[model samples]
Target: MTTITRILILMLIAVVSPIGAQDFQGIATYKTHRDFDIKMDSTKMNDAMQKQMMEMMKKQFQKTYLLTFDRSSSVYKQEIELSKPQVGGGFQVSFGSSGSDVFYKNVKHKTYVDQKETMGKKFLIKDSIAPIQWQLQSDTKHIGEYICFKATYTKQVPKVNLNFNSKPNIGDENEEEKEPEMEERIITAWYTPQIPVSNGPAKYQGLPGLILEIHDGKLTVICSKIVINPEEKVGIEVPTKGKEVSQTEYDDIMENKTKEMMERYAPSRGSKDGAIQISIGG
Candidate 1:
């Protein structure tokens, strides 16, 4: 071929090659609903105290979740909040925190590095695992003006417990002996293919589309708004210095925190008079 023709072909390839890369970007939302089946061990408490404690626990706990996702290459964010607030005499307590997670996908190396932030700190965890082992059904849908795809993957996420801070002080010395609680959860996601990005709101991705919605068996998160391919660039990265622990350890930490709080605030949580002096400062 002539030198001029070869040069022209090379330029053409350079201009159009990214399209062949099949890179698209879009956004989706997920909603989750959590249900707790808590049973107290009456064997551990006096009949009266058992009833009282069970009632107290039932009253204190409501479903909650940790929402985390990646914003860009190596950057992630998370929010932990109560799915439902406890209310009974026109009062409420709020427990919610926001954080982040990291994202790194080395397509060339076929490796993924995922990181997350908790309470303003960062932790890294395994991103590559058995490929979800899920069977899903998909349908095309629209979110606002965007043509998106929706899918439902009905499967159990086995129970997951995250023990962040576990320290025990008193009450129900044998509470640790009780069978560890397991949460059975289901997740549903809605996404868009228009953006062509294989990333979703959180650790969920690699689907046929960008997730616009996520629904767990207990809670639901809907992406009320989305902006794709903005003029600005976003960067996400992996976390460092986070103590590596199993999910059980995380759950233990959480449970320990719950126990500590209950003990410290027992008077308020247990007394009817304290209940009467409640305020839900919305």
Candidate 2:
């Protein structure tokens, strides 16, 4: 065929293809898991005790989330589990924040509302996605059936605390405050242009195409299944039945609540009352 004939055929295909990525709607299910590198001094507990603790931590970190998105907006939330009876009520530690967060994002508008539930209290956190300067690399890989590109960025993150014995004073105005230590966290994401829209799990977005996998060293969320333009369209709604708060305000609320819990249980620290306490990270 002549060169002119090939050019005309390409133009015709473009006219027939879908014009907008947002027009295609689907749900992507992701399964998340975390890794813990803990050096437990080795002398404090025997090998058997350490193994048991690891098993419990694994159960707590494994979670599943579903992201339902159309061309412009998407809603991502966790799959809740049925309530089960606990064997023993004691100190339990989770790798991530102890909250079930529901994120609603409009990709075109660049806005989001996070419906966060912490300690049975609801918070509607309205905020925009933070602009991340990702350094796009030439490396390409496939996440599922779609081909994805690589990007990386670094941010300063607060050091996580899972202390079960911290005692914090409530409403103490004269108490001197100490700044919490911060560390640099590197985030990497893989996105596919084949999917078209810019969306991902959690607070990640602004990529050329939809993000298929993302990781922040400790935890990773990978797309396990994707259904495109199903028979029934998933409803994307902003959560309203929660106390309205900005992202900063929500963090403050969580911090204060955590302090209250630590002080409430401070007296039980190291007490040999035949109670069980399990902690994962140092």
Candidate 3:
């Protein structure tokens, strides 16, 4: 490294005051970008329409979020945007994607309480950060000013929906659909020891350093900026506004609610390709 570059890094370090082995609090801004691909028989729609739909879905998932953290507690939530809802295409189905909930985590206590207000009902999901068991590798890359190392892991998640007036599966209203079979997904993360905190964009942590970038192949979540101990004190407060319930209990509640909506809407009538297929608790 050149002497001038080393001096520049030192100056930058002094300005940011990166967290080390102690209690620290700050805010991190992240921008998440995702690509959406619908698997439908192309015979129904032309190539232009398909491309336009894909682009719209991609923009819907793209969002910015803020994560505030201390030594133990951290809260992650998405930034609000002013935009008109996408309409006219019919099929108003919600899929399994990243949410805009205030995810509060207590790392030292190994507990988390997320606050979510969905469909006029509030939920507080108190649970542990399900273990990921990441395999740390020697690969490294520079993300902005931070030197980050890569780690990968895999886990099973519930089957997701991308219903674009695609199927006539009455099974959606059936009880069996509630027990969605798990599908394994691979996750890649890049962390930097420069910011010595076990924190990341979403529910990812447990690494030796702070994760600057994370991806699950389909979606990419990366940090846009890191402000360490800014002029304003970062309030790392635990959210206690929603009705308390365990993670499993909350899932059951959502499933029951979704089933109720499916039945009410009469999914059998949703045969038209452009008709709205309502998905409750989406």
Instruction: Output the TM-score of candidate 2.
Output: 0.80
lDDT of 2 at 240: 80
Could you tell which candidate, 1 or 3, scores higher by TM-score? 3
Q: Indicate the worst ten consecutive residues by lDDT in candidate 3.
A: 273-282
lDDT of 1: 0.45
Provide the overall lDDT of each model, using Cα atoms, as 2-decimal numbers: 0.45, 0.73, 0.73
C-alpha-based local distance difference test score of model 2: 0.73
User: Over the stretch 154-237, how does candidate 1's per-residue lDDT look in tens digits?
Assistant: 554546442212333457766565555555565767665544444555456655434666676645556655545435544433
- Model 1 scores worst on lDDT over the 10 consecutive residues at 273-282
lDDT for each residue of candidate 3 in 63-175, tens digit (9 for 90 to 100): 89999987677899888888667766653545443355788887778788888877666777889877669887767778888887788998888777665556545554453
Q: Residues 1-282, candidate 2: write the lDDT tens digits.
A: 454653454355444534444367889998888886554535444666566666677767777889998778899998887644445334354532433677899977888998876666777889877888887666778777776778899998879664433444655789878787899999999987667677888778887677889898799889999888889888888878689989889878767766666566554446655344543321
TM-score of each: 0.52, 0.80, 0.79
